[model samples]
Each structure stands twice: as C-alpha cells, then as structure tokens.
Target: MTDQPTTESKGQDGPAVVADGLTKVYDGFVAVDHLDLTIERGEVFGIVGPNGAGKTTTILMLLGLTEPTDGSARVLGMDPARDSLRIKSRVGYLPDEVGFYDDLSARANLRYAAELNRVPKAEIDSRMDQLLESVGLSGTADKRVSEFSRGMRQRLGVAEALIKNPEVLILDEPTVNIDPEGVRELLDLVQRLRSESGITVVLASHLLHQVEQVCDRLGIFVSGRMAAVGTVAELAAGIEKGHTFEVEVAARAIDAVTLMELVPGVRSATLDGERIVVTADRDVRPEIVELLADNGLGLLGLSTSTVDLDSIYHTYFTGAVNHDNVNA
Candidate 1:
C-alpha cells in the first residue's frame, strides 16, 4: 500500500461512511467524477446506476482497493487511503464475483478467511458455525464449494465477509445470477444483520428491485455523477411529474373533470368507467376524500398508482426532470 497523509478524525458520531468529492480517473477517462455521499451508522444505503456508471469504481475507492485520482473517502472515521488495513479490519466487502477454493468445503473456506482476518484460533469454530447458521449455510458447511449452487456460493460469500465480525458490510451486485429465493434470503440476511447487530450496509447494484427491497436510502448515479439521493418518496417528489392515483367512486353530483378543477393540487383527472384517475404534485388522497364527501360521492376504493424506481430512472436519464430539482 502506498503511504498517504493522515486526516483528522470526524468523531465517532459522524456517518459510518463519507465520500467527499471522490473521483477516480484512469488514463484521463473519468470512471468516477466528483462525488459526495454519506451512509449513517446501521443504515442500509444503496448505490445504483447502469453498467459503467461508476458504481463499482466508487465502491472500490471506499474499500481502499483502488486509489482515487482525486478527492478522498473515509470509512468508520478513518481515511481509506491512509488507514486501509484498519478499515479492512472493520469493513466486510463481497464483490459481484466472489471466489473460493473449489475443492475446499464451505467451512474450510470460512476458516481460511478467518485466518486471514487474524481471528483468534479459539474463537474461529464458534464464529464460523454462527456465521454459517446466520447465512443459512450450516447444513452445507461440510459440502465442497465446487458442488455448491450459485445461490449457495453467494450465501457462503456473505459468511466469509462476516468472519471478522465487521461493522459495515459492502455487497456489490450480490443478487446477480442468484435465484429469486436466494435473493430474498440474502436480502433478509442483510436486514437481519443490521437489525440485530447494527451493521451498516452499503449495497451497490444495477438491479432496481433488489435495491428497492433492502435499502433505506438510495443514490442514483448517472454518467459518474450522483443525480439524486433520497428515499423513494423524496425522489418522486423531486420530479416535476406527479404521481397518479386511481379512485373508484359510485354516482356523484360532480364529474371527474369538474373534481380536478376543484381540488387544490390535482393537475389532471379523467374518468375511466367507475374509476377516476387523478394526477397531482403530491399525495392528494385526503383532499380527494374531502372532495368526494362534499360532492356526496360514495367511495368504493382508493389506490395510489405509485411512481416506481423504473419511472424515476427514466425521468432522470431522459432529462424529464429539471436539473435544479436534483438533490445533487
């Protein structure tokens, strides 16, 4: 490891991870542009983008495996570049493609990792058994990795990352190539780790649904820049286009078109059979209910046709959103 200058501590109460203008340039081609991000302790933060959008590069920088050309990153209150070994001791990383000795049993593979992490010999057996059970691999602990399925291997990879009892776990495209059941298990395991152990998680993936399922907050990356960062609802509100809600109402004195004009935030309302579809800047469900009551309409059903991650991605990449609205 190359020597680097030490940085002042940001204190223990600060975020678990902090990237300040973190950039990486390979032969003048920018892989990751100036990026600023933070992940609070015990938060399941997701970094999402299309292929080559710099998600992996950013993760590498955070792990101190790849040195940044410009800017800096800190993990667990230590500079990644200068305190990499210390950071690695407390941080666990599972790459998209995790490798293990094919001939080695799952238990053996974890034993190897434990040795590398300098886990005490006395504690190795107990830790390995606990990790295997935590990752749902205790039954296959003695099975050769060569015979393990993709899902099984992925679970073992997670177990390997946990051998050191890391405070923060970083998974890169962990759900890729795994079966749906495996994906669910992995996500559940991640959530359990956070809830039970207070481990901060940083998940990087192009898979929107996986991120949506496990992450507390999400950062959308476009062309090596963080386009937006927030919860699902916050991102939806940042866009100019409003969410659409479908309402089924019985006979009413006021029609859908007239109701649109009467509501304060409703931008458009169209009648489709017995259902009324209303689009608005924000959730107008309460206003909608009041309007129905005032108009003497009987409400049968009400549902918000939510704005999903796909729509948010499309809007941001296609330039539908005014850049000023982006959280940066």
Candidate 2:
C-alpha cells in the first residue's frame, strides 16, 4: 500500500468534530478513556470496534445525551455539553435500533420527525417527499412502517434523520440486522449524501466490511481506547507485518526456493502446486515478473494481498500490537 499522510498531520481550519481526551466512567468502570479524535468536514469517518468497546458511549457523549466523566468534545464548533440543543439542530443521528410509530406510514413518520425538529409546517410536505425519494422509500411512503422489512425500515430511518437537512449525520450501526442488498443500498445512500450534499458523516459499527466500504478514514477502538486511526492503506503500512503475493507460473523451470533467493525484498517463498506464495516487505509483483522472465518461466497469474482490517483489529484487541506504541 502506498503511504499517505495520517489524519493527525493534515492541516485544516477546524474539524467538523473534535474530542479532546474524551473520557467517560461509570460505577468504577471506564467506558471511554482519553480518546482524542478529529473528523474533518464533508468526510465519512468510521468508528469501528466490537460490542462494549464504548462506541455507543462515545456517540452519546458527542450528542450530549450523556456527560463525560472528564475531558471535552465539540460538534460543529459548539460544545455538546453547553450547546446540545443548538448542535442537534445541525446534526442528525440514527441509533442502532431505529424506532417509529409502527402504525404510521413511512411518510407520516418523516412528517412527525419534521414536526419534532420544528421544520416550518409550510415546507414539511416538500421536505418529506424529497427525503423519502432520496432514500428509495417513495413507493412505500404510504405503507405502514410495521409492514416494512428491517432493511426498509433502516432506509426510512435515514430519511427521517435527513428531514431537517442537517450538516452532519451520525449513524450507529446503520446496517445492523439488515439484509445484504439492504446494506448495499444504505451504504450507497451514505456515499451519495457526502458526494451530493457534502454532509459530514460519522458511522459507528462493529462490522469491518461495511465500515471499510463507506469510510474515508477509520478509528479503531479496543477496550475503550483508540488503537489506531488511518485509511486502510495507511493502517496496513504502519504494521510491522509484511505483505503477501501469490503468483501462478505456467512453466515448471523456476523453483520457488531459487526465486526467493534472487528477489531483493522477498522474505519467504513456497510452492503449492502451480502457485507460489511470496511474503515481501512491499509490493514485489514487478520483481517477480522480471525474475520469472529472466528464468524463461511464463507467469499465468499474479495477485497481491495486504494486511486487512480484520487482522489489524485482532492484533490490537488481542495485545499482539502493543497499545502504548500505537500512534492513534
């Protein structure tokens, strides 16, 4: 993976969200510990961790629904503790389990949300239509929410969150219990929201693939502390582990052991049938091609794999990676 600047090193006028040494404790248990995070405007930032990793607590604190035991946080340049109502006016949040009046139609639910947000009654109908259509619920706008599937309801929740046309959207496990197709639709909607409306998004989830699919950058939380923060490529490069490349050769003339010795960056190479798996400090596909060509060997296929988020998450949470050494 190519190296890129870490989010911490990037210069900006001000972040969309900032948490300084954010800490939360309850009944002698530390829920969140000295967590510092910066989310830029118009970017999708993901907070990923397993259940009970303090993801929900962090969200609650940011929304001013729960006070921190120590430290401070700001959303859109306003203190959540002191300016929660003002912040709520500019931010939209969808919880892990979205609730609506079951008997109400999708349109009615959105109208209700608009009313609660104090949206002008004159514009509520247009706003509801726009939101419902945007989230792909126009056809089901009159359908009772109770008859909607989990995925449909999740999409409706997104529309409800957008009724006030907020600048920032905070979603807690938006895809939980959703079908695969529903998940795709929701992620696409999120991507469109940022691209079309330039709305800053904060998505918190335990699912790696979903987060990886949507976030511009990620903050990995483990045991109530941020373990790492960066893009997928940046995170992979930060780890000490080398990458692996697999090459399939058509000719039998080349030996895996011989190739391993000749390659400059290869750490190890082993042949499995027609395929050779090589571990290298960096991408060595070009070097392998050169070696095979020089040895009169024909390459059938070549592919590279890096340290994925799953491995990185496991390493940090299991103490394989020292917590103190992590830059985040």
Q: Which ten contiguous residues of candidate 2 have the minimum total lDDT?
A: 1-10
Q: Would you estimate the TM-scores of all the predictions? A: 0.78, 0.78
Cα lDDT of candidate 2 equals 0.84
Candidate 1 residue-wise lDDT, 1-328, digit = tens: 0111112222267789999999999988899999989888878998888888899999889889999999999898899898999999988889888989999999999999999999999999988988888888899899899999999999999999889888788998999999999999999999877777777889988887787878999898877888888887778778745567889877762475587567888777887766777778788899888888887887888997767778788876665566567565
Candidate 1, poorest ten consecutive residues by summed lDDT = 1-10
What total of clashing residue pairs does each candidate reach? 0, 0
Cα displacement (Å) at residue 123, model 2: 0.7
